[model samples]
Target: MSTAIASPRAFKADAAFLRGLGRAFAGALIFALPMLMTMEMWQLGFYMDPLRLALLLALTVPTLVGLSRFGGLRPTARLRDDVADALVVLLVAALAAAVTLYIFGILTPGMSAREIIGKIVLQTVPGSFGAMLARSQLGGEPEGEREKDPPTYWGELFLMGAGALFLSFNMAPTEEMVLIAYKMSAWQSAALALVSLGLMHAFVYTLNFRGGSARPDHIPAWSLFARFTLVGYAIVLGVSLFSLWVFGRTDGDSLKEILSASIVLGFPGAIGAASARLLL
Candidate 1:
């Protein structure tokens, strides 16, 4: 009798899981499509340093796990569940990359195993982020899942970092990042940095975007700027540097060159960080 009662429940659970997988795949493809199709990305795939790539994949796991805690496709109530979702999101990312690349003629059986694996691994970081965010962006969660509690200050910082990483990662492989850096004068770079910081602050506290946190009346504006905007931009800068390094953009570059490129990437990264609550 118990088995009979459990059969329908099991079927329902399986169905829901399958649906979650579908959402994950959709998210992965949508988020990773640009990188998958870019020629530079393809070249970097086979040529990128193995150690750096490995570190990227390793870091991605924790990032995905953290994202799962806040916005997993399933309503996770425990650390184990978050980990499981991270793994599942990775699987979804891989499958999405493999299928899309195959259809695009980028992945062929004739290609070396190393090449194929490298391409997929590189794409997986962004893809997994998309999968983890599918619930929030695509809007299908299993029944009875409550909204996530408000994030603490650190939690907010993590979200900003994740957002910054996602946006910066998308652009890091492109040649334009370096070209723009080269074209700019030192004064121009300084102006751009100030502009980035100003826009980020505006987006977070001044612009009044729907999901933006309302600054309490008693909390002075400068305090909020120092506490969130400055810190978030710092995180964005770190993410930008890491993304550039992952793509070998910093190989043999001088400190001035590296900082210039980082500031260029940090414009979008800062925007991503400021709007994380809206996006992720």
Candidate 2:
């Protein structure tokens, strides 16, 4: 009788795990589909500097840890649980990337092991992020439960960075980002800087977006500007620079050129930072 009782319980647990895995794949596909289809991404996967790719993958771990703490696909109560969730999601992302790339004929028996691994690793970055973001994007858990575990101030900032990175990744690989930056005059760059800052502040604090709880009326203007807006823009700029560097757009560029590119990319990055709460 006890064995019979345990069997049903075990079966139910197995079913739940499978369901979560399915959600993970769906989320990975939803977030990574565009890059999967992009030809530049496929080429970059094989040729991007291995050291840079490794560093980027290293950075992903902490990002995943932060996302797990606040908005993981599964509720995690302990540090180990969070780590486990991240690893599981990473595995799911790797599998999904391999299957999708193979189906699209991007990966084949003709490729060497190093080339195959690089392709999968490059794709896994976005796929794993999508897996981590599955809970917020694809829906899981109750609102009350989520609210009970509200992200800390640092976690909020981290989420802004993640969202900025995700939104900018698609554009970072395109030649147009560099072309646009090269064409802009210094004054135009300055104007863009102002616009980016203003839009980020407005979108986060003033626009009253659905997911954001920031209230200008309740918070002092000085505090709002200093605390959220400035900090958010800082995150955007950081993400912009990092994205450019990862995509090789910063190669051979002087300091002035790099700064110009960052400022140009900062427009989209700032918007992403501001709308992180809604997107993530």
Candidate 3:
């Protein structure tokens, strides 16, 4: 009698794990397809600074762990479970990236191991994020099924940083960032900064976008702005700068050029940060 009951439970657990893996694969592909197909992304995989690439990949572990804590391919009950989920997400991301690159003819047998590994590893960053978010975005679970504990202040900031990084990573490899920066005058760059700030503020506070947070009745408007909006923008700018640097976009560029590029990328980054509650 004991074995009969145990077997069914075991089978159900295995089945659920398999379903989670399937969702992770789909999420990885759906989120990472843009970078997988981008020409600059392919080139950067092998030619960009190896240290930077490795560092980025290393940083991904913590990011995924944090993501698992908040929302992941499955509900995790403990820190150890979250870590395991993060690793599983990474594996799924790597496998998805490898298969997609193979289908695209970018991961040919003729390529050296270093080249093949580089391409897949570079793509896995975004893929992992997608895999982690798959549950929240694709699972379509009712709000009641999700975690009830509200995020703390630092947790909110971290999500904003993650969001900024995700959006910036997609655009950082493209040439348009630098091109637009080159074309714009100093005054235009400043104007764009103001616009980014205003739009970011509006998205979170004024526009009342779905998944946006409401300000506490006791908190003054300026206090909310200073604490959340301004701080979130700062995080977005930092993430944008880091993304640009990771892609070698800032190499040999003047300080002005770097700042201009960062500001340009910060536009999307700001939007991402403001929308983190919705997306992440």
Candidate 4:
């Protein structure tokens, strides 16, 4: 006699298991990505200037701890959620390039002080809302599905945005900010801003990853002490390149200056973000 096919309930169970496995895979990639970006920042800086690289390492501790405490809430959290935060940090690095380039007409002839002020105010609300909308859309879960958390959404956003923005800006002034602050043209500022944000995002993401679930056999090449070095480097390279292109600079000197600014620029966002992440 032929055996009976698996029942509907069995099929449903199998399909559910497969979906979970898919989610886990996606989550792992997302979780691992931030660490990759962070590694790139540290590696590139170390390759260029090891002493200053210490500062980047130093910044990671706080970011990881803070993220553990204050990052956006997820259903399972499961490291994948952490990855989303890190990616957004990376995206902000790209936005800095846009800001520096005046892609939104920031530096145009009509951008008087009043206009700038008005624009900043006008954009802040919408910009924040846009970010929230993006986050909500990315969640993909129905509104009813999200878990309940303490009511501190705005506070966390403020900390995340402020910390990332300040740190990145400090890492390297946008060529324009550098120019205006130190007298340089818009294009140059764009380049500087891109590198700075890229480094900052990389640094923070790594810090977040450091807090990731530690596995017993993460590496065997360095006898299990490698800490995802090559993977991290790969991430940083993309993070840096994405921002660098956004900044619009290909010059060796410009890139050098931007790299050097990483540690110094990372301070504020590091502190503020860490603090905010912790408190939130």
Candidate 5:
């Protein structure tokens, strides 16, 4: 009787885990589907340097840990829980990418081992992000709990960087990013930069959005701009450049060309940075 009861309890726990994993997989697919469909992404995966890919993947560990702290696919109370969740999400992402790519004919047995690993590694970037975001989208933390543990200044900045990276990754591999840059004159690019800054400020400080309200009367406008808006834009720019480099879009590009592309990408990236809190 004891053995039979124990078996049912174990099965129940296993079922719950499977359910959570399924939710995480779905969340990852929602965010990564576009990148998976991009032809440039597929091509770059096979041709990009292995060392660079490894370095980028290594960096994802900390990024995942930070996201897990803020909003993981499941609630975690301990450091070990956070680390375990991150590793599990990464495994799910890799499995999701491999299976989906295989189904789409993007991964085949004929492909060399290096090529296979490269493709999955590149795809895992967005996949892992989606996994981390799963909790936010699929429901894990209560609103009261979230309010009880708000993010720190640096934590907020990390959220901005993650958001910027996601939005920029969606656009960075496209030829249109470069083509739009080519069409813009220097003055237009400058105007764009100003516009990006203005929008980020307005969204996060002045305007009321789903997650943001009008600034408190005590907080000065200049202070808000300096603290959040300026810093967020800087994060956007950094994330934009990093995305371009990761996508192999900056190879052999002139300084002018690179700047233009970064500016164009930075526009959406800034919005992402400003609105990250709302999403997560």
Candidate 6:
């Protein structure tokens, strides 16, 4: 028991590998998304051009291999954890990336705060939920079992509040969903995903590592998941809202748009669910 608990992350578990994995997942989404949307499963001349995606995936391949070599970090997500966490991460990551771009736009003076956030959430929401459903369907587990283990309700309420507020306040003017399928540059979309993934994983792993690698340890407070959930969600939401209110409000954007647009960027987390999976 001591050995299991005390085991240190070995080989490829280092920061470089971690960063690379984050980047790969992000880049793959960017590369595959446009083509997938345009061409579907079949590759076509205009949409299915695979050069950049192939390159991006290739860039991370070595890192993925190295990371997996440590202990098979390949996505055993289904058996190990429900797909909700990933979706949550995906949504949060997208928002994070959007926020990054938002800051960038402040300096460049072209993109609207609302437009960027809206576009990001629009494309990201579907991908986030779709990824969840995709993994769940592929996972082949009974919905009943998954449903049976519903997360502690307190955590859910707080997180939902936090997530909703985060989304509504920070990402202003509500970006148009149309941007997801159109308008974004290849590099832009990939950058969006990559940065967001990095932010999400950093938040998660920091908590996990701080918590003694035990799911229970990761809880906000024993029998107080809601309290902690509210706090964590609150911090993130506050930062996002503040970021938008300051930088996002400069233009002719409507106040309603800014407020409505700020939502928790990722999937409303499965707090306890993530905790359980991290432990298992």
Clashes of each: 0, 0, 0, 9, 0, 17
lDDT of 2: 0.84
Task: Kindly report which residue stretches of model 1 are placed more than 4 angstroms away from their true locations once superposed.
Answer: 1-5, 141-145
Clashes of 5: 0
Ranking by lDDT: 3, 1, 5, 2, 4, 6
List the pairs of residues colliding in candidate 5: none
Q: Predictions ranked by TM-score, top down?
A: 3, 1, 2, 5, 4, 6
- After superposition, the stretches of candidate 3 with alpha carbons farther than 4 Å from their true spots are 1-7
TM-score of each: 0.95, 0.92, 0.96, 0.28, 0.92, 0.25
User: Between the candidate structures 4 and 5, which one is better when assessed by TM-score?
Assistant: 5
Compose the digit string of candidate 5's lDDT tens values, residues 1-280: 5565569777896687688788789878988999898888888888987877887899888888888898886667887888888888888898889889999999987899888999999888789889888877786557556552767779888988987887887898888898899999999999999999999888887678877746879988898889888988988998888878877788899999998899999999988888887776
RMSD of each: 2.3, 2.6, 2.1, 16.7, 2.9, 16.8
Model 1 error, position 249 (Å): 0.3
For candidate 2, write residues 219-252 as lDDT tens digits. Answer: 6888878887898888888899998898788999
List model 4 lDDT by residue over 119-138, tens digit each.
33222221222232233324
Worst 10 residues of 2 by lDDT: 140-149
User: lDDT for every model?
Assistant: 0.88, 0.84, 0.90, 0.37, 0.84, 0.35
lDDT of 5: 0.84
lDDT of 1 by residue, 1-280 (tens): 5575569877897788899999999899888888888998888889999899999999999998888877778778899989999999999998898788788888887889999999888888788999888877896554235568888999999999998987888899999999999999999999999999999999988888977888899999999999999999999999999999989999999899999999999999999998998888
Using alpha carbons, what is the TM-score of model 3?
Answer: 0.96
Which predicted model would earn the best lDDT? Answer: 3
Angstrom error of the Cα, residue 90, model 1: value is 0.3
Can you list the residue pairs that collide in candidate 4? Answer: 40-236, 170-265, 171-265, 174-189, 175-188, 175-189, 176-189, 179-183, 179-184
Q: What is the lDDT of candidate 6?
A: 0.35
Superior by TM-score: candidate 4 or candidate 6: 4
Off by over 4 Å in 4: 1-49, 68-73, 76-137, 151-163, 166-175, 184-280
